[model samples]
Target: MSQLANIKQNIDTIIGADELMERIRAGKKLRIKLGVDPTRPDLTFGHLVVFNKMKQFQDMGHDCILLIGDYTATIGDPSGRSDTRPVLTEDEVRANAETYLEQAFKILDEDRTIVRYNSEWFNEMSFGDTLNLARKMTVARMLERDDFAKRHASNSPISIVEFLYPLVQGYDSVMLESDVELGGTDQLFNMLVGRQLQKDAGQPEQAVITMPLLVGLDGVKKMSKSYDNYISFNHTAKDMFGRIMSISDETMWDYYRLLLLMDEERIEHHKSDHPMVAKKHLASSLVAMFYSLADAKHELEQFEQVFAKNQRPDDMPEFQWDSLSGGETTCPLLNLMAGTDLFPSKKECRRLVEQGAVKVNDESVSDPKAILDKPADELVIQGGKRKFFKVLG
Candidate 1:
């Protein structure tokens, strides 16, 4: 295959590839832009799909421009949403941005990355300037987006700010004078908007490339924090390893292809020869990528020991509490679970416990009415198939 063919095979979609290739062949180090809105605190494996592609461009010696949508996030991007997302405060957006870069650096080289905030230009735009910019695109074109059309058809509230999000994002490309832009398939609409804006500004239109979305462990919707189907990068090595193991077998190849960076032929060989071993290898590779090889090995060992041999690991979190003497003080199990962050809310806790999803130590606990007397030495709370926490007093 030609070099361009090889590149195209890996990329899901590319707008104006022939022209972009011409620039690359001319030894031009293109300014590649990748914009991310830090709506959630945790960066999931799904994010790595785009990050890895950016890493590819960086390795090829191009400048990688990371557009931290600190300004755009405040208004919220309504690209694929049917409803307006709650606008994040500047403080909240900044906090999430801090966490975002920290996790992103695990996949991206900080030295090579050009960090930028859209607020640099967007914040400086006057009402008159903003109006002039908004006038560049017609309302008919804006409503052509599937999200906006659906919302309009459904009579859902569509905020004017949401319409401005794409324009603001597109302007980032113009400001940076980007040669290429990278994003997930979901961002195709917003990305194309950037190209159109660049063309209108008389700058060379950026080549837009998008990668496929990574499905979550649920093997359903795209991996996302809103769905609670994500395995966070913020989690410990063991936690990450366990979450990878919990992924549906059907999603193993997608994880292998997108997350593990395994070659296609090798993946096919493993799928045909030894499927179970391939999954274990896939889990180990992913765990190793996020954590060190030593940590990944240790996690694998611990998983085998705990699940296969029914023996706990040596380094589990110890929960300690002073003994409660004499009186029977009762608190709702749901409240206790929520307080400990074992579950997000009382409703979720109650539902899990009632559905026989919660286990106390090794035994299943289905009774929501089960009251706990104070001072239990080792009270283990288990949620679903995997999540477990210990209570000690």
Candidate 2:
């Protein structure tokens, strides 16, 4: 394939085009850098969007550098936040790093990938060196960033440490002598800083590429743990399938185009011709990518049985009615989910209920105070498109 075609196939966005393509065609092993701050322990589907792109480059014989921003994470990235993030301790960052790698390996090849922590370089920098790095960018330029400008305009707190974040993140590219950098669209401002810093450091400018943000289950904000709209990599196959199924029907095409590895033409045709079938394929494709074909098939079977055939899921969690009833005439669904540990907290359960993502006995339940008066034989409760549990007495 031609170099441009190859680049297009692997990435959704490539900022520096002709020169980067020339480098790729020259048979030079491009050092592709992808940095993820271990702010959250679990890798969500959003992170996988970029990881999948990195996998494409690795498969194409490029060197993939996975930078775990342990050092910079301590400062906390203020990229898109409305408020400053609480800093994480070194121990906390290390603990999250272990799980980050374990989950990242689901898409990234351990042998072929280079996993490095920013602390290795950042820790050794002297106070003088830190000042030199800080001087590489100006406050005026930093203010150009959307988040910074928004915070500044709104009289929101924009700490001096927040300004250091982009510089530190940019230096990661310089340290690796990166040929290309990848991140989500939200990271474009920071990624561009890498290119600028590289140029300022008398190094060849690294190409910047950004992927579209993966919308959460809410189909509004970016998929994030804080928003309670993420599907973690650590979830069981059943949970993963259910989470994918819970996505808004409107998001099916977007997920198919971004998440699944299906042919674009085929997916586009399916979207216009038969959206329902397209979504089924998308859901199955995503499940198969994370799990196996057999597991994906099983999920589809379960989905069909429960959604189409109107039957109970075969492997639902068992709940005791006596334990749930508590002699109360009616119980809030949020309370029920919390008592059963189906959700982490009543807040999340209430959010799920409000979104109309929760159902009981195959019927959508909106009122959190609805009575659970049905016979205790097999009371089915659904969290979203995929999560289901059966209560028995």
Candidate 3:
């Protein structure tokens, strides 16, 4: 694909970018800035939409500036939020920022990426300096943000610190002198704020590119850790493949376009196949990116073994029988599961059993009250597709 066409792929909107294509064709290596709040220790696939775009920029010989929002996260970004977000301490923000880059580097090229922490500058600001920064935006103007407007109209509690979030974020773009800034479409307002801040700071305004929110495995809500519908970049190959497969059939096309970058024609061909077949290909392709082609193939094989063929996994976890039982000849299934720490408590174990998610010796056991005799030789326990343990005497 032409570089111009490639840059436009998977994007939701671009603000003040009428001349962007002309400049890209001119080819003088633009500075692309992207910031992520380190509220959580893990990065989600939702993050990859912009990350992939950054990768595209890097391949075109541009600079990728990754700002870790160590300081902004303390104030909490109020975008798309209805209520005041809980503030984090300096220590909490520092701790959470630790693992972000390890995950980010999974997609971003380390050599071309310029990493910066917002705290690096924020931590050095004097009280007067902060006040000067705060003067950049008025409360009346801040209230113009859609989310803030909604919260105000409904009488929801909006905090004072929340008002400062965009200004601080915008200041990052000014500091970086970025040519372009990237974020999700939900962040269009904040990203545009960065552009105005740059112009006010006597720098060239940065164009904003917003990518669409990747739908979660549920196929309804946006993929987010808070929603528990996210696939973490930290997942093992098999787990990652399985979660990708769990996405609803309707959501497969979105995943194909956003995650796989497959063209429309290729995607239509995938749509012509069985849903499971198409899903497997998606899972394998993603797994290969994060892991390896070898691991992806092996993961698909393992999935087919336990799920498609209804056979036990070759490498089942082992538990010493007498020691695991904690001295009972026969125990309730819940007790056994609890002792293994497979479930948090016997109540949760009973819930899974009653829900028919528990399996023993390759057979589904739906009886929460079922008594499990001590294993004579080997006992297989499976809570779900991902968990399997073997009991041994």
**For candidate 3, lDDT tens digit of each residue in 37-88?**
9998888899988898889888888889999999899899898998888888
The C-alpha local distance difference test score for the whole of candidate 1 amounts to 0.82
lDDT by candidate, in order shown:
0.82, 0.84, 0.86
Q: Candidate 2 vs candidate 3: which has greater lDDT?
A: 3
Q: What's the true lDDT of residue 254 in model 2?
A: 73
| Model 1 per-residue lDDT tens digits across residues 1-393 | 444654565578999898999998898888989999988788898888888888877877789998898888888888778778997888899999999999999999999999999999988989999999899888899888898999999999988888888888888999999999999887888889899999999999999999998998799999988888888889888778888888887898888888766678977887885665676677778788888888878887887776778665656544443222223356556655666664568788889989998776678778887766555577776677556666676
Candidate 3: where is the Cα deviation over 4 Å? 319-331, 338-348
CA RMSD, predictions in order:
2.5, 3.3, 2.2
Better of 1 and 3 by lDDT: 3
Lowest summed-lDDT stretch of 10 residues in model 1? 319-328
List TM-score per model, in order. Answer: 0.92, 0.88, 0.93
Candidate achieving the largest TM-score: 3
Report the C-alpha lDDT of model 2 over 2-26, residue by residue, as the tens digit: 5456457536578887779889778
Best by lDDT: 3
